[model samples]
Target: MLYVFLSICCSVIVSVLLKLAKRYQIDVFQAITWNYSMAILLTWFFFKPTIPSLQNAPIHIYLGLGVLLPLLFMVMATSVRVAGIVRTDVAQRLSLFIPLLASFLIFGDSLNKLKVIGLIIGFAAILCSIPWQKKTANRKVYSNAWIFLLIVFFGIGIIDILFKQVALFKEVPYTTSLFLIYILAFVIALIVLIFRVATKKTKFSWPHIMFGWILGVANFGNILFYLKAHTSLSKSPSTVFSAMNIGVIALGTLVGLVVFNERLSILNKVGVALAVIAIVVITIS
Candidate 1:
């Protein structure tokens, strides 16, 4: 439980940092590049992963995670920029519902009445939380917001499911998996960076680089604790995922109100209430 709570807190801090990045004039791409680089270094220093023999592990695991990691970071950063932190977090976290449904259908995971109810309520809560306003002007800004949220949903949902699959390798130390995953992600990002440089579009900024490091550290901490908690708890990973999400939403909302001075419309208020109810149903289920 302590690990779970700490992980959620780390998530909130990540959101807060991203929100602050706008004010600090941090470029999203550069920030993420540096973030991953720093995370790789930090993980190396602390975890000291033992190299896994390729002969033993499935080759696809490495290949798939290599592709997924960079895309996940890019989409998540874009989602934060398009939607506010609160909405981005909600969209990404709510994706667990998709995986829960998938698990039941594909893996024959059982869903009791309470679990089903909780899933339904949680889904409804996410829908309610989406701010749908009739456009008063010609601005199409919010259009991208919806698309970004969808991307976040799909990316995070797939990632969560993938993590569960990876977790099945009980012999693979968590630290080793973490190191290999991030190392692959960094190498991929570096390759892309080289391409960007070759195209003469590589402009580096210190702010982006520094913030990226901060983001990397925070993200590493978040995943480390969450993974540990998932390992320790008897609850299903999906359930733990859902509970941690509720914590992020609650914390994000409080920070949004206090720090960003973001106000909720009546609809938003109702949406929040529904979200809370959904969380309750999911929790006690």
Candidate 2:
């Protein structure tokens, strides 16, 4: 339970940092790029994963995750800045439903009654989470903000599915696969950042690098503690899963409301509640 608590805190902290990034003028792209370097270092230090032969590795899954992870991270940062942490966190947690849908539609899993109900509610939650009003004079609010949330929902869901595939690739150690993916993602981010610097679209900033490493630590801590929670509660994967998602949503809402004073409409509030209920139903089913 301590691990679960820590994991939840780390997850929320990532959002908090991203939210603060805008206030501090941190370059999100440079921060994100350097984040992968820290992640790579931490992966090597903690996991000490053996380098696997590339010939037998699942390169396709690696390629997909390598590209998507960093890209979606930038999207998520944008979402937090624009949509606020509460909605962004809920959208991310609800994204688990995406893989569930894939399990039924693509992988031929049998859907239960509660799953059906959860899916219905989850979709509604997504729809309700969207800020559908016209753009306000407030620069913080974007018109059709749902696009960022939806992209995060689908992108993360697909990434989760790809990670599942990585877990199933018995030929390579999972940590090794993770290490490879981090390296690839860092490479991709680096290329883009280098291009931006070269084209004078952005300049090299020490602040972005420093903040990126901090973000990486929080991001890595979230994964590390979450995995530890699962290992500690090995007999109850469902408990860990439910607790992690529910905890993040609950804590994120508190932070967004109390700390940040993020505004949410009545519909968005209802969507948050439904998102929680949907998670519970899905877990129970």
Using lDDT as the measure, which candidate wins?
Answer: 2
The reply for model 1, stretches above 4 Å from the true place, is: 75-94, 106-108, 134-138, 141-152, 273-285
Question: Candidate 2's residue-wise lDDT over 35-67, tens digit each?
Answer: 889988999998899986789888999999999
- TM-score of every model versus the real structure: 0.82, 0.75
- For every model shown, the clashing-pair count is 1, 0
RMSD of each: 3.6, 4.7
lDDT of 1: 0.72
Candidate 2 regions exceeding 4 Å error are 1-9, 72-97, 107-109, 133-154, 223-250
Cα lDDT tens digits for candidate 1, 38-140:
8778888997888877677645775677678787777777776666655776677668777676666654556678867866766665565555553324433
Candidate 2 global TM-score: 0.75
Error of 1 at 168 (Å): 2.7
